[model samples]
Each structure stands twice: as C-alpha cells, then as structure tokens.
Target: MSKRVLLPEDPRWMPFCKRYAGNIERFAIEVVGITPSYQQMELFGSVSPSRSRTSVASGHGTGKTAGIAVIVLWHQLCYPMSVTLLTANDMDQLKATVWKEIGISHERIRRGRHGWIAEHLEILADASCRIKGFEAIWFTESKTANEKTANKMAGRHGEWLLVIADEASTLPDAVLTTLSGALTEQHNRMLLTSQFTRNAGFFYRTQNELSIENGGEWNNLRFSSFDSPFVSDSSLKELWDQYDDDERNVRLLGISPQDSSKHMMNRKVAEAMYRRGRIIKDNENYGWLVLVDIASGEGLRDKSACILARVIGYGDMGPDARRVEMVKVPLLTNKIRSNTFAGYVSDNGAELSNVTYVIDSGGLGINVCQDLEDMNKVVHRVNWGNPCFKNINKDRYLNLRAQAMHQAARAAKDGRLSILTGDYRNQMLDQSARIPKTFTDKGRIRVPPKGATEWDGMGSPDLWDAVCFAFLEDVSYIVSGEIGMGGLVNSAADTALKRTEEMFSDV
Candidate 1:
C-alpha cells in the first residue's frame, strides 16, 4: 500500500484547508461541552454565496443563532468592505439578541483595533474591502423600522449585500416584499432563521413556495434540538416529554404544528361528544333562563355576540346539569342598528319566554339595550366596563374573556366539555384550533387570521367568545339552583330547536 505524506506548508492545499480551519477550531474548542460531528462541520462550511437566498430552521437552542452569528462574522471578515444587514422583527430584539452575538464573535476575533470595522446597531466597513457597510434593522422593536425603513436600508449602495432575518416568523409580508425589492438591484443574499410553524402564514407559505419554485432553488437547512451535540439524549427526551405531539412536532422535530383555532374544540373530543346522544326536548320543570349580550361596534371588524343559557335539574344533577347542557345561539344583524339588534334579541327571547336578558351596556349595545327597555322588554343591562384605558380593572372585558377562554380550553383539553356537536359547531371548533395566538398592543391575547371576519368579525374569536359566555352563564344559573335535572333534558331540546328556528327564520 502506498503511504500519502502530508506537507506542513503545502500552498496547493492552503486555500481549502484554511477555508474550514477557523470553523473547525472554534467548534472543537470554544463551543463548550460540545463537539461538532462530521455532518455538522459539513453544513457549517457550506455557506451560500453572496447572491443566494437561504433559510435555516431548527428547534430551540440548536445553535441556529450561533451559526448565524458565525456566518455574519465570517462574511464580514473574509469579504472586505462587505455590507450586510442584520435584521429581525424589531430593533430591540435585533440588537439585544443577534447583534449582541455578533459583537461577542467580533471580540473573540480580536480584530477591533484593525480600524477595518465600525460597530453599532449598524456596522460600517472601511474601503479596504469590496463591500460598503453593514446595517442592522429590526422590524418589531422600533415602529420606525417598518417596511419603508427596510427598503431604504436595503437600497444602500453595495456590490453585494447580505440580509439576515432572525425569528423570521414574526416578520411581516411587507418587510419581506421590501427586502426582495431591494435585493433586485444587486448581487444580494437573504438568510432567514426560525423554527417551523404550521401552514398559516409567511414562514410556512415562503417555505412552500421556495420548495416549489424552480425545483426548490433556495437551500433549506434544518437541525433539531435532538440533533445538537451539546444536548444529551436524556435532556432531549425530557424536553420532548414536556410538549404534546403537535408542539413536539413543531418545536422539536422542526415540523410545522397544526393550527388549533380553526376548530372551536378538538375534533376527536367533539366527535366523541356527538356519538354520545342527541339533545332531548325541553320540559316545563326547567327554571329561569338568561341571555347575555356582548357587543363591539358595527364595523365589519367588530359586531355583537349573544349567549343564551338556562338553569335545569335539581341538586348536583339539577341546574348544574342544565348548565353543562347549555346551547349557543347565533344572532343576525341587518345593519347593527339599535332597533335591529333589539328586534333580534326580542325575537330570540319570545321563542323562550321568562328569559332574563343581560345585554351589554357599552358601545353600540348600550343603545340597543335602551331600545329594548323602551319597548318594555324584560332586559337587564350589564355594564361590562370599557376595555380601553390604563390600569384597567382585572375583571374587565378582555381579562374576563381570557379567564372564560382558559376555562373552555381546560374543558376541551380534559375531554369533558362538548358544544353543539353539529356540523356548524364542528366547523367553528376546527377553525378555533387553527387560530394563532396574537398579542395586542394593550397586552391582551387575540387570535387573528385571514378570512375570520364574517363570524362577528374580530377574527374568528367572536364565535368562541359567544360559546364561552354561553357556558359561563349556564353554569352560573345551575350553580345558583335556578333549575333541575328534568329541566335539563326538556330545555336542551327546546333551546336547540328555538335556536335552529331563530337562525333559519325569515326576518
């Protein structure tokens, strides 16, 4: 067998050897308690050229951020005067997370005194390198770092520029469009890093499009927490055990998790509930009933929702039983006019007399309640205080709504709560399951997705709110001993038919 001799200073092998030596050294020594496997090193060395658009998705703490930091530092170090843009959904996040990592890497290189680099939120490289400068833009941190701001930064003069998007899921389509437009003028590259989420928005859509476009042009890189050398098998298993199948698929396996809000409840649970039995008719033994209304303005984005619940049965199986058997009714509005809303409530109430109406006395509903009172209807206005203003009370609309929502979530998760189980209910529950959680500026939680405005607007959550209120009100009546068991069977069927007729009746 012939033996191959290695030379200490072979210039023929210098370029290839040096190209990967830095990454290998860093990985072996500085990465702490972890060593890069051959596969990891291969991926680390295969950085895309300046003009390519690439995306990297991985489970949490799998070295995605570290890899990205290395990429930014390497590009800046190797390609002189290269101007790269490091960006995220917001400025604070970009600086605090991504830029902080880059800064740490720069200090490790000990090249600060060379005068070749200027560092801050934006970095400028001197004329020694072919690239011009590097700008750090955050989309969500600063209101100013919006689509227009991203476009302006991207439009800067450079032979080649790099745009890095961290936490790419939170980025808006506008920013993506702006960045894409800005890259058109030069040999630019885009890199996005985020964990995979379900088939809802930009990340999923972009991944799909990239997979389809030109037979998948953009390079896709993926890693998982389980794949991390630093993570022990036991640790990974513990993490895996912490999440449900859906969460594990998205957060650990790097597969997009299914959206939970598309359906109001779990499909299996709803199906099981459906198989139990049909709702029986209403009996006269049931006690007093109540209808509660919560209204938003008349805009297509905000409307009103009404919930009807009653007391039935006796003792533990009495009124509470009926509460458990509460049914939801969907109210129609011609134009959100007060009289129209009043007419809607009266029509619903007439079908089931002796029902105590708890109408919202806020926004448009305030006027509607007044109209109902003027008509001598037995409606009591509920002053469900305004959701606006600072330091709002804890029991206000949003918080109360949140509390009720949590209750429903628990019930659904526990397989103990079942709604109408009809096709409409099933559809609503499915939609609810798919709805993504969004945080409002006021620190309230909301789920807003496309095409969710018609079901009382406010996204698809309006229907959910109605269901929650119905459940709460019904439970309240039952706990208050307003009805008994016999009332439950009879009232359930009566309420179901009444709601059905009201929904199908010609106005």
Candidate 2:
C-alpha cells in the first residue's frame, strides 16, 4: 500500500500495480504461462468495484481452469491481505484438474517476493509484511466442494475477496448468491465457470436472466469448442463424428439439452403409474416371477436386488383393470443370497422351491445361477443382453434389457403399471428418471452403463432394475399360494422340542 509505514512501495512493485493489478489477463500472460482467449479476457475484466458478478458457461477443453488459476494468483499477489476461496464440483476433479492448475501458477510465481500461505486443501497466498512482529492476515480458502461445502463459504471478510467456483453448472442458486456476498467488500471479485451440462440451475439463470436484464452489474461469457486453440483439429473432428449432435453440443460446445423427451419418459405419466396402478385381480392365481439380481463388488460397493412379482393375463381382468392388460404386482423385494433365498421366501410366506425363479445369468449372476440351480430353484436363467423373446416382439427393442425397460416405460406412460403404495415409490420413480436412452448406430435403443451418468443423487438404478426384471412377459409364476409378510421363522425341530409344562411341573 502507498500509505504503509512498515512496507516500502518500491518502484519494482509499482509497475505491477499500475498495469497488471488492474488487468488479470496481463498478469496471467506475463507471470504464469496461462494464455487467455478473448472470451476469457472479457470474463476476467468483468470483476470490479461496481460490476462484480462474473460468470462463464463454457464447453470442454476451453482452458477454463487455466484462466481461473490466473486470477486466483493475480488477486493474491497484487493485493495485500486479500482472501481467495477456490472450489470445484467434486474432490477428484478439484485435486486433479482445478487445484492442479492453481498449483502450477503458485510454482511459477517469483519465489523470493511472494510470501506464500499454503494451508487449506490446496491454497496459496501472498502474505504482507508483519506489523510490529504480529503476522498480517493472509487469507486463502479451498474445499472439495459439494452442496453442503458451498453453503459453508460464509464468515470470511477481507479488504479484497476473490471466490473462484469451477464446474459450477451443478451448483445450486444459494451457492452463487452466498459466494457473491463475499464480494461486498470494495474491489472484491467472484468468478463462476463451468461446462454447461445442466440447464435448470444457478448456471442457467446467470446465462439467461443476468445476460438480458439491464445487464450492467454482470459479465456473462460463453465459450464453445471452436473458441479454444489448445484442442487439436483432428480431436474435434473425431468427437464430432463419434457423438450425436445433441451430445456433441453439450460435451463439446457447452450447450444444455432443451429437449429432454428423447432421453427420458414423461414425468407425469411415471408419477401417475406410481400414484394410481389399476389391478385386474389381487389373488395368488396371478402366478409369481422371482428375479435374482446378483451384485459383484464387496461391501457397500455392490448392490443386489430380488423382486417377487405376480403376473395376470390381460384378458383375465375386468374392463377397467384390463387397461393395464398385464398386471404385475411386486410382492416382496430384498437383497439375499441364492442358498438362503428359500428360507427368506418361507419367512415372507411363499414356499421357495415351488416359486418360479428367473435368474439374471449375466456378470456375477452366472455363479449365482449355478448356486441356485444346484439348490434346484431355477425356472429360467436370462442373459440381459440377449435378443427379445417370442412373446415380446424383438424388432423395436435392441436387447432383453431394453425390451423390459421399454415395456415398463410404456406402462408408466399410460399409467397402466400397478405398483402397491409403499416407502420405495419415490425411490423407484427417481431410479426410473435416471434411465437415459440413446440410439445405437444401427438405430437400436441403448441405455448407457450404470454409474456413468448421474443426476440429482440418482446413481446406479439397482431398485429400478428390480422393477424392470418383473416386466418379462414370458416369466411364469409356479407358486400356488400368495406371497406376503405372513410368516415367522421357527428354527426348532419337532424331535428337539421339550414340553415347558413338564419342566415347570418338576420345578
């Protein structure tokens, strides 16, 4: 500072203040090797005393992180006692990409001049000279950010505060406003940058609303694939050719899909089926189809599901109930092994050996199927990826998995699927929503591998798979009695039982 008595305002530091301090683009270009594109420069220039809100919704490989890392170092080095808070979407992404760039910039700073304060997750700061041997406040914050962590970014105050939020599309509106509160201090700045994947969040609002409204207090920058020279021509071409236009627009050009219908079923239809499912007949005459969904990984990593359903033919039910045609009732759902499954069924009310079991003989299911077969619980062993059965026409569906899901979706669409009211209804709906469909090169309907795509905490639809398993038309029910939670385990043998009256009488 010019007025500081302890610190000297040297000529060497004066030039940096005059030019680079006012311009983050210059500071990034000269100090660190991070070259900013024209779009990046616009975003950097937006942060000032009057106009403080700055956001960039960008595509992949646009050097968004590199641009952000520049301003983080620029704010720390230029202003004494200034605070910089950095965060990203996830822990792995923060460590591997965003923070890694900041680390790079920290290493590039002239070692002698900038007194570094590195403590928080991955933070770097330039400390001012101590006043009367007391340490001057050098503020910097970092976190592997999430919905919870983003909300905790309060109580930080400084002469100048800089908050860099990377991968901010998934960020809730509260985070953006909460982080913006830190910028109330004079000369404070907030840079929000992301690859725009989601269209209905704080990111979407800034790109749409703030960009149009008497737009003086905001800076909105949009970057696409063509804007970045760092990405090669061949790479762009390959990506364009490989992915469909909608996917390429989101992945490469940073555009959110406006039309979500092609990817998923109608929410109202699914919600209706969840709320009101018309049943033809409610008795055990419907027959049973037991589905064994074997999980692979150990501990909480692997998720196993078993769905017991009762199926009734379309013609068997009354007129109103017949609208659903084939009524499938999910009687019991559990995660249990094949060997003990008979006991589990008996405890639930169905005789295990008599019930028809349809084992999913894919992946870890092969061994599970073998274990069940050795116990003689096998009715049908189905490979999920195989072609559709004769009962369900194979032409429209890509595979058995696709066929089952589509049939379930159609039932959901028509509000025809009868699901009994239970605690698992909302969870089932969420898992169903997570199912994203895409078309193969041969025009076949395809769903991406589980855990690859996630939205709103919907990861790996194990429960939805249980529901889908019951949709197989050819699956039969061999049990004579109805399945319900109607029995308790009685482990004692008749020969081992002693009369309690005789023992009490002797006493």
Poorest stretch of ten by lDDT in candidate 1 = 133-142
**How does residue 490 of candidate 1 score in lDDT?**
38
lDDT of 2 at 104: 72
Cα lDDT tens digits, model 2, 281-374, are 4332445556656565444635666665555444111332212322222332335655565444334324432556676676666766676566
- For candidate 2, list the clashing residue pairs, or say none: 288-477
Residue 381, model 1: lDDT of 52
What Cα-based lDDT does every candidate model obtain? 0.50, 0.58
lDDT of 1: 0.50
> Can you tell me which runs of candidate 2 are displaced by over 4 Å?
1-11, 48-51, 111-136, 144-152, 212-216, 261-367, 370-507
What is candidate 1's lDDT per residue for 285-389, written digit by digit as tens?
Answer: 443334545446535644465555443432111223333334455553334556577777777656554565666566666777788888786665544222322
TM per prediction: 0.53, 0.53
Clashes of 1: 48
